[model samples]
Target: MTQPDLSVLDDHFSAMTWGWVGDRGTWTTDAARASLDALEQLGCSWIVLAYATLQATPQSTRIDYAAAPTLTDDEVRWGIRESRRRGWKICLKPVVNVANGTWRGFIGFFDQDVPGEPTWAEWFASYTDYIVHHARIAEEEGVELFVIGCEMVMTDGREAEWRALIERVREVYSGLVTYNCDKYQEDRLTWWDAVDVISASGYYPTGEWPRQLDRIEPVVRRHGKPFLFIEAGCPSRDTSPQRPNDWTLEGAPSGQAQADYLDEMFTACAARDWVGGFALWDWPAALYNPADAAANTDYCMYAKPGEAIVRDYYASRRSG
Candidate 1:
């Protein structure tokens, strides 16, 4: 397959991270359309159609993607079409998360499979099914990018499995494929060569962007592949700048803090041209009232100072 290039980023390389494993068939609602309308106003060029399925536990092998909590296949297709209709570039990101209150990064089995116990083989089979299912939809809809997986830290070490999964997806979905590694784990992925693009979650502290980028730079340069911060953004709280990855951090809602963190992020990434683009952490399918943005403290950029920060940054990068 011929690889796609970073020219896709052109000037403004940004996406409004939308969809979070939306409720069963809730994707095409009027509220969802309204949210997309608002996102359109932000000037982001891409829409990350991020959705997820759940495994019963960190050790569970079955990926129950058809469960009631997830969007049905119809909804997922509608979402892809809706975003395409809005003239946004699409990056279909299908994620697997663990239930049972455990972080998905802990989802793993022993290095060696034991009888009657779950094995990496079992998990990869299910995970590959979940990803390829969406990858086919991406191909049919002309999605420009396809992310095979997201932040599954425990599975990142299985380079051969990941490479095989990419091959499986390629057999059905012909598009640029990338994987989202957990923060600070860029160099850990020895199989970056298996995918067309390299991406990681960029949740380093406001002050740590320079150092983290320095660490990630050589990895991309060595592989000669485009890199993106496929998942990046800070929450609306003062404590977040120091640890943006901690979504549950306690602090008063401070949109300025989120704005400052992203402003610094945009500035730092500007110096690293290889830092091809970003898909900010998220926007909700059901948007909150803009009037309440100051008090609301999640990752949504609506009506917050970060919204303008993004708008300005995206606007600045465009060719008139």
Candidate 2:
């Protein structure tokens, strides 16, 4: 395999997560190529190839793909190769989700051993295997960055276990590494010094960008590590800006609302010199009807007004 060049890391990253599942062909198809082309036109300098693992609960000591569809290992390698071939840097983010529909943020274990209840040691043992498997792949594929986990809020308190997991990851992967902490949890991480960068989900309300940035600044300053939003976006629905993190919020479709939210987020972060960049929440593995874009109320920016806002902002950064 040809090693991907990491020189692009010095630039501000305008990225999108190509969230996909099912099979190897999904990434190698013509639609995938077209999606990558669209992303390039949107001025994306980086692409996050996100995959998922499954566990029955936070305490379950097994991480496997039997419960849900996931991209095959071969498909992920092809994705990295294809994205780099298009001149985009790559961040391999292997996330975990519970099989019972619980959010990963709720994954947790008792601090002390409890009989009949799974132990933190057991859970971390399985999680380590899940993460290290991808880390080795990231290293072999020359992925420019590796994100160990995403929004595992309850487990963040177990700093020792996470740090140990990071140590294990470093043994196999040689690249910048970071964890995607949930929004508002950034300052709580005392172990930021262990990773190459500090990252969090940037799903702040449209009106609260400045205040949230104020709260986050001290953490970034104290750690002296570069910071960026690993996941952030609002749905194209009425009132979505006020509750940008809630994907299930109900309302009529409102493209302008989503566009305005993106504009506000980009403007605020652009003013903060310490903020590095962002990888928008997602773009889909399969696109929907272009004609129905107005009726679509998801976070996807495809053929929507928010897409142009993101493109213009990212293009300006590249040009400036």
Candidate 3:
């Protein structure tokens, strides 16, 4: 299939990340429309649609989510079509989770093959299948971009496998491709040349955006690839800025803190021309009541002070 025109992606993309959960039926509901409408009102120019698959453990390769209660293939297609209809650029992000409750970043294998144990070879094979399945879908649907994987820290050292996976994805996906490295791991990816863009999770601590950006700048320059924060946001908790990546951090809800963190992040990133833009950590498939914003303390910026900050920032970029 011929790829859709994606020249529009050259500009800065203020994206709102959207992830689905629960049964597939929810994708076609009024709730989904309301959520997208809310995001569009926030002035997002792009939507990063993340679909998750699961494995029993980092060492286990059996990747399957279609059979689970998560979002279905039809739901994903609907999301893509809806995003396009709303004039938002689409980045299809296929993520893998561990069913046994391990974070994907901790997914690792022995340095060398071990007898009678699950090996890196087995893991990569399953991972490749999971990624390529969505790559083909992204191609068929003409998504503007495709994210090969998200924050597979332990597996990142398998340079040969990652490069080969990118090559295979290229055969099916005609759009730009990228991998979302975990925070502080941007420089560790030696195979940067294999991907079209350099992206990482921007979960640096509060007041440390400059230091992190400085650390990342040389890598972007060296690789000569456009840079973006594929995922970044602080929860609406008092101390979230100090550890933005920790979603479970406890504290009273503080929209002001979240808003301030976003302000700092946008200001820091905007000053650097190489920093393309951000796809904020997420907006949910289902939204909570706007009236309850003060009590809620997750990363979702909807109906909070952070939401306004994001709107202003994105609107400023659009007008500028």
Candidate 4:
């Protein structure tokens, strides 16, 4: 396959913003359509479609290799069509471990008979097939990008295998490729050779966020490559602490507090040379209503202050 240069950030690079798709879980075609409508209205150029469920069964893992998920294909296709219709880009990112740790089998990894947890190789071999299967579809469907993995902290060290998998994927698809990593593991990852961009799920506090990155500049300079903050999240509406000294905003009670923090981060990133782009951790307001919403706190970007932050940032980049 001819490898085309896919560097989205360059001197002529324009600013682009994307949000995490709302966590509506599984839905019928109608619900999915409604969700797409809502996201398009928000001016999202790219969307991360999630298909993993809280209780995915073993049978679910046997998704047809040739096509996207059948149940929500309409929703998936609607997202693709509408995004293309509006000149937007869509990337399919099916997250595993949504059930905390239970549904791993459904997404293909360890069998129920296995005792403790399955080995990383066991998971990667199976999961990468699923990812590549869908990725090939994204390629045919003309989607903008495709994610191979997300937040699988347990399997981060299998570098050689990951590189091989990405190289194989490159043969079938000619679009951007990346694996989303937890922020702390940014430097630990070694599979960059086969990937187009280095991405991480990172979130920072409200003040001088990029300043925290000064410590990593020497390491990054050594890599001689630009990085994307592919996933960074802050609580859009919460004033209380979720994690100790967590990056959540302080003093600002309204949703706007969250937006302000994200705005600061985007400004800091876009004005720099090393930072390519930032994908806000999530949008569509799921933080507040995660499954078992009453028991869990919310972290999504719906009507919250962070929503405006995204809108304004994109506007600034577009106009700049």
Q: TM-scores for all candidates?
A: 0.97, 0.94, 0.96, 0.74
Where is model 1 more than 4 Å wrong at Cα? 1-11
The 0-to-1 C-alpha lDDT of every candidate, in the order given, reads 0.88, 0.85, 0.87, 0.56
Q: Candidates ranked by lDDT, best first?
A: 1, 3, 2, 4
- What is the C-alpha lDDT profile of model 4 across 117-185, one tens digit per residue? 544465556666767766777777876567787766655766776887787788788878878776566
- How far off is residue 5 in model 3, in Å? 8.0
Cα displacement (Å) at residue 109, model 2: 1.4
Clash number by candidate, in order: 0, 0, 0, 7
Off by over 4 Å in 4: 7-28, 53-75, 98-117, 240-253, 285-297
Show where candidate 3 strays beyond 4 Å: 1-6, 20-23
| Error at 186, model 2, angstroms | 0.6
Task: Give the CA lDDT, 0 to 100, for residue 48 in model 1.
Answer: 94
lDDT of 3 at 159: 94
Q: What would the C-alpha RMSD of candidate 4 be, to one decimal place?
A: 6.0
lDDT of 1 by residue, 18-130 (tens): 97867776688999999888899999899998887888999899998878787888898899989989989989888877778788889989998799999999999999998
- Model 2, residue 228: distance off in Å is 0.6
Instruction: Please name the candidate that would achieve the greatest lDDT relative to the true structure.
Output: 1
Model 3's TM-score against the true structure: 0.96
